[model samples]
Target: MSNPADPFVEELRAITGAAHVLTDDASTARYVGDWRRNYPGAARAVVRPASTEEVSRVVALCATWGVPVVPQGGNTGLVGGSTPDASSREVVLSLDRMTRVRRVDPLDNSMTLEAGCTVLAAQEAAAAAGRLFPLSLASEGSATVGGVVSTNAGGEQVLRYGNTRDLTLGIEVVLADGRVLDASGALRKDNTGYDLKQLFIGGEGTLGIVTAATFKLHARPDKVVTGWVAVRDPQAAVELLARLGDAVGERVTAFELIGREALAQVLAHGTPGMRDPLAGEHAWAVLFDVSETSALLDPTPAVEDALAGAMEQGLVLDAVLAASGQQAHALWALREHVPEAQRLDGPSIKHDISVAVSRIPEFIAEAGAALEGLLPGIRVVCFGHVGDGNLHYNQSRPPGMSDAAFRAREEAVHDVVHAITARMQGSISAEHGIGRLKQEAFLQYKQPVALELMARIKHALDPENTFNPGRVLPLPVATPRPSSL
Candidate 1:
């Protein structure tokens, strides 16, 4: 399988054109590495397929030569799921050229889109059709639909709308054997059998390449009320969330918990015009939003009532509710700008972990204490979708520390955080898939029975391990480490 022979490369070029087949270092540089730049590798070549047929042909050729194929989408994934390995034995299959909005049926409340369509584009299409495609994320502008589906992404609005899994109705996938599975349909209820599409939803492109998807849509909210509330602690934030959930029911769309450190970073290094919503400094803040259908009652009244109750109960110290759409956007900007702010600060260790909703406060308290004890003065930026009980717990090195010093302690920091997460029966990887970054940890944390089952599924669907071979699941005992190692 040495470079799949020049004839095979010529065939791939014939199928996707010479311009699309990238063999040079510069053209393939972006595709060789993961988003965090922590995992960099070289591929035999990069192939950009503009159609499902082209994808199938490329996959077939790779399968014939026993060459591993890595399916890549937007490449914005936090995990290294889309990055190729150092072996150069695999070909990077990119779906960037397949972007297209095939159809939008407002009456059916569904839309069909190619895998390469960015999440932001899908949202805009839904908006044009007077609906809401609620799967949103900080990287929506760059994350593709296929990548979102593969990772089963959960974002700010997951409280009301759910994750990518819930939003997706059906999918079209190209299996490892080069067979196209057309599972796309508009059926609301299909209890025919196993619901095979689910296997590929969060499979991390290990089982197959998601070519396109049909997503369910919701009625556009006519009135949206966004608010920023400062809380004393994580417990207070959890209590406030329960009260709001009870008060507004399904109207509460987004509930985010922002630690004081996270907020401080944003206010210090974030975009202009961003201001602290509360007067006095607090240890934590909750950014909650509520929305409702146009024909239904205005959601602002309920949001206001919930905040009033929270304030009286001492759960919320101070709060500010958005008066208009512009104000609402401004409120969200604070939450959205956190990652950018953290990036500007320095290289940091991040954990996307989740625990039971009721156990979130405990997990945070214990994990934060443990991490602090291990490394003094480590700036912790903890925030995420509280409704989903997922937190983006990240650590910034203490001031004046060299990058080399911080890099040296990466493993120790991760061990402390992940141990706490495991003890609480929580997940180490929440929204981000178990790519190269967390693959070893995933094996260490997952139960033996669960791991065996995952391996069985992988073997059954991809016997040769031709599709995204090194992602999501751990390698089998017989499989050797990538040669470049």
Candidate 2:
């Protein structure tokens, strides 16, 4: 019989051209690791396929050979879902070359795009059609549609437009056996049966590889009004959101909460032109925007009136309304730069958790206190899409602490915060899907029945575990051996 390894590599090269098959360690090294540099994996080769048919063939060949495949997009995922494992038995299937805009139906307000299209590219395509693809993210320039859909990525605008799952209407997936499940129809109200598209939407490529997707679009907003307001705390921020929602409803596109420490990081590490929106130091702040589809209808007056009312009621301590588009963008930069600033500051423990909007204050206050008590002088950088109750709560090490020591205590820190999150009936992983990083937490915090159901679904679809092994689901713990004495 022919050598199995030789034939497998040769078949992959024949399927997607030798140029697309990368075997050199230099090229393969980049695909084996994640963006966060946390999970470093090893792969025999990295294959680039350009079409759904090519993907189908590749997956089929891998399935037949019993070699695992990990599907990757732009490689901008926060979690290590797109990276391979340490074992060299796997192959990385990258979709970066499959970027093509299949269809743009302006009348239907929907667009069909290949998996590799960048999020920014999709937004620009929608704009060209005089429509709006409201899914926005800080990583939009590098984050791909396939990756976003797999993670059901939530961004600053999730409060109004919802996540990737909400925007996706149809999908074309390549199954484990290389079968093309083409459900990429443009219909909106198809009450047709299982609505199977959802399974792969946020599956993180565990169930199948999403080759292409059809996304629902909206009418482009003609005007946008932005503002920055200082609030007493999370409670006040929640109340202000309630007040604004009661008044403006869907026009309220984005509402973000930034803590004083987070803002300080921005000022310290941000560009020279960046400035704090509020004059004085406040414990908490909120950035909001009101958008309208009609250029003639200015929403600023209404937003200003609401702010005035909020100030009168003492919900807002201090505030600033953007005088121009430049100012609005500047204010937004402060919020967007928090992640980069935190990175510059040094190593930190990160947690993306959510509680009920009403209970956000209690969760933060309690979780912060608990973490501080656990590790005295630990810096808690808490902020996120507060309108939706998701907080990117992170902890920076103390001045005298070593990075290794801080990392060693990561589990203890997560336990304290996740415990409090469980108490509030909150999610341990929000926005970011349960990739390898949170698989342990998924098993620990997720209900037994729910986890069983998830495992059942995973097993039912990809029995061979050919797609993204060691992701989303935690491995079974080995039982301790009995004493031999």
Best by lDDT: 2
Error of 1 at 165 (Å): 0.8
Which run of 10 residues does model 1 get worst, by summed lDDT? 476-485
lDDT of 1: 0.89
In order, the Cα lDDT scores of the candidates are 0.89, 0.90
The TM-score, computed over Cα atoms with residue i paired to residue i, of candidate 2 is 0.96
Q: Total backbone clashes of model 2?
A: 0
Give the runs in model 2 whose Cα sits over 4 Å from its true position.
1-5, 476-485
Once model 1 is optimally superposed onto the true structure by TM-score, how far is the C-alpha of residue 381 displaced, in angstroms?
0.7
lDDT of 2: 0.90
Lowest lDDT sum, 10 consecutive residues, model 2, at: 476-485
Cα deviation of 119, candidate 1, in Å? 0.7
Compose the digit string of candidate 1's lDDT tens values, residues 1-485.
45445777888899899999998899999999876787898998899999999999999989998889888989998888888988887899999998999999999999999999999999999999998999988899999999999989998899999999998999999998899999988788999999999999999999999999999999998878888998878999999888888888888899999998899999999888898987888899999888888665887777788888888888988999888889888888989999889988888999999999899989888887888788888888999998988999999998888888987999999999999889988999999989878988998999977776777788878989888876778664233322321
